[model samples]
Target: MRTRGFTRCGVIFGLSVVIVRLIGGSTGLVCYTAVESLDLGCLLRWDCLHASPNITYTVQTKTQGDPWQDVPWCVWISSRSCDVSHVFSDFELYNMIRLGVHLSPSSTVWIKPHKFDYSDFTFSPPSVSVSLKNDSISVKVQFPCATNRRCSHDACCPISKLIDPWTTVTVYNERNRSDNQSRTVWTQEVVSTVEFSGLSPGQNYCAVANFSFPTFSIAASPKSAPGCVETGSRWGMLPMYCVGLALSLLFLVLFLAGFLRKPRRDRTTADNPPKPLATVQDADSSAPPIFVDPCDIHVELVDDHSSIDSFHGFHKAPTSGAETKRSSQPTHFDHSRGVTVQHEVQDMTFESYN
Candidate 1:
């Protein structure tokens, strides 16, 4: 009977354990997790199938053969993602990085480790830009690592090392909404720009690009945002060229005309000289003439002592032969009145006899 009672107790204890497990739910945390290298840093993402408000997540990382260290920025958080790049900053690119997760009020789960190589990182979609020429379209694909800090610090590092060297570019004619052409370009050789010629002018074209890596078994990245452009007509620039040419010809003609006319004007001016200053006449002829005062004057007196004696009262002096020839008259003088008046044409003189 005691043995039977012991078996009954054992059965009851097992039943009690099963009931407790059923009420408390799963003891393990089921999650889907992935790690990827992003332009900003290394990202750790998780999707918990049985997450609860009471359960928090913490991420810890360690290099090969090193003790696991908790990520300070990702400690006991409820977020589905965390950045563990800080932990890998001092590690080499070839090192193996181990990642772990701790769940609050639940059990701990650890994911597989990944190599810190560039190839292991996911390739972000290339940035694309399109421009239209006369009859061609130019597409420029910029890689994500072109602006990445890690890539910039390494001189020997090329974006092709991180992404696929083979790029697939698809061009679409927006009018028909169909793919017009496709080309696989080697990114290392062409750099970031590719030109597609033999396209119809005056048509709207769009392009999308993605990276393909068959060697690494990596699927092509998501297609880039479409870059669109409208090509110019073949004859669209002809009018501008013609106008510029015409303007140049006009300028040349005007310059030549001016240059040629300069010599002719010079010759004409030389032939028809200006009038001499002496021949110039004042505009107003009725204006008064200006008189000038003589700086010095001289007087000539004929030796007429006998005439002076005869002019005791008042007598006219006989004019000398030269004086008669010059004046055609004799000069008269009054002596008795103590006044002498002489009639002279060129130089007249008056004398007082008082």
Candidate 2:
């Protein structure tokens, strides 16, 4: 039992020595300040090792005759305590930081300024990125980090990563050099990115970011070096014009085809071979002749003794004298001896009516 007791005492002593050695050089109540000493322009910090990690700590401040304001610098509860390093004024009555454990919170502790012989502090600004959008411009502010803080293998204090304070931004038209007009906007420190509207299409713009606090103010690192962007339009009429042009070309092609082909179709119809006629009457000599009566016949008898009815109306073949029968006549006959031969004469053509 004595041996066990001795071993326990040795273990406890070793743990105490480790604790003292770890926090020996730390300032602001040891294991509180980021650096070893509380020199000029240094941060003052503290943390409760026994506090619950689930609870939150708020770093609030109340000036004379003013409501309490919550400064977001070192506001998270990773350290189980709050810090004040960014913004402060020498004229304020007191700055209170509160650690709330559920409904029952510890009393608000007033933080006094860490006084020093000299007071002027210098801070450099970070770079600002400018991006172009269809109708708006986006400006992103980035803060530079310390070499040792970012280079550390283990994350000793995560609170230092949140460094951006409240900022103000100014944007203006790049081409409006004569008028010298610009727009001003205030941005919260928590928001690293901000957008400005009322931008015209195809127009150039310039913007700059500025950081301001109650105690200090700083502009961008490259002063007066503004970022520029050119705006564009989302909707364009080129597609519509192209479609209309295509349609017009199609119509023109159709018109040309129809107009040029009409003549060929008409010529084909007009130049067609002629069809045969229905009747083909030709002159023929082998067919019988045709005739019709043109007049009526009339004749008058003279003092010749031959009977008028015996005179032939049309000519007939003359008979020989031997076959002629003798007729009574007022005798001027020239007859020969036994065969008396007589002469006869007749006319076939008629003259006009008298």
Q: Which is the leading candidate under lDDT?
A: 1
What lDDT does model 2 reach? Answer: 0.44
The models' CA-based lDDT, in order, is 0.59, 0.44
Per-candidate TM-score against the hidden true structure: 0.45, 0.31
lDDT digits (tens) for residues 1-354 of candidate 1: 323432332332221110112234556445565555543245656665555666676777666667767778787787877756545543233445433445435655555654554444445677898987657898988765532334545553445644446788888889976648888876764356888987777788899998755344353567899999988876887898999999999999999999999999999999999986542245334446544333323334554565455444333544333222234244444433434345545422333243
Worst 10-residue lDDT window for candidate 1 reads 13-22
Q: For model 2, how big is the CA root-mean-square deviation?
A: 24.7
Off by over 4 Å in 1: 1-58, 62-69, 74-82, 85-124, 133-136, 142-168, 172-191, 195-198, 212-219, 266-354
C-alpha RMSD in Å of predicted model 1 compared with the true structure: 16.3
lDDT of 2 by residue, 1-354 (tens): 323432332333221111112232343221231211111122333443443456354555444456766666645445433334334333224433333222125433333322211112222344578897657788876544322223343533221243334455667777875422344334434346778887767667777765533333421232335778877754454677799999999999999999999999989988996796544343333434443222322233233424332344213433333233343333232322223233333322322222
Model 2 pairs whose backbones collide: none
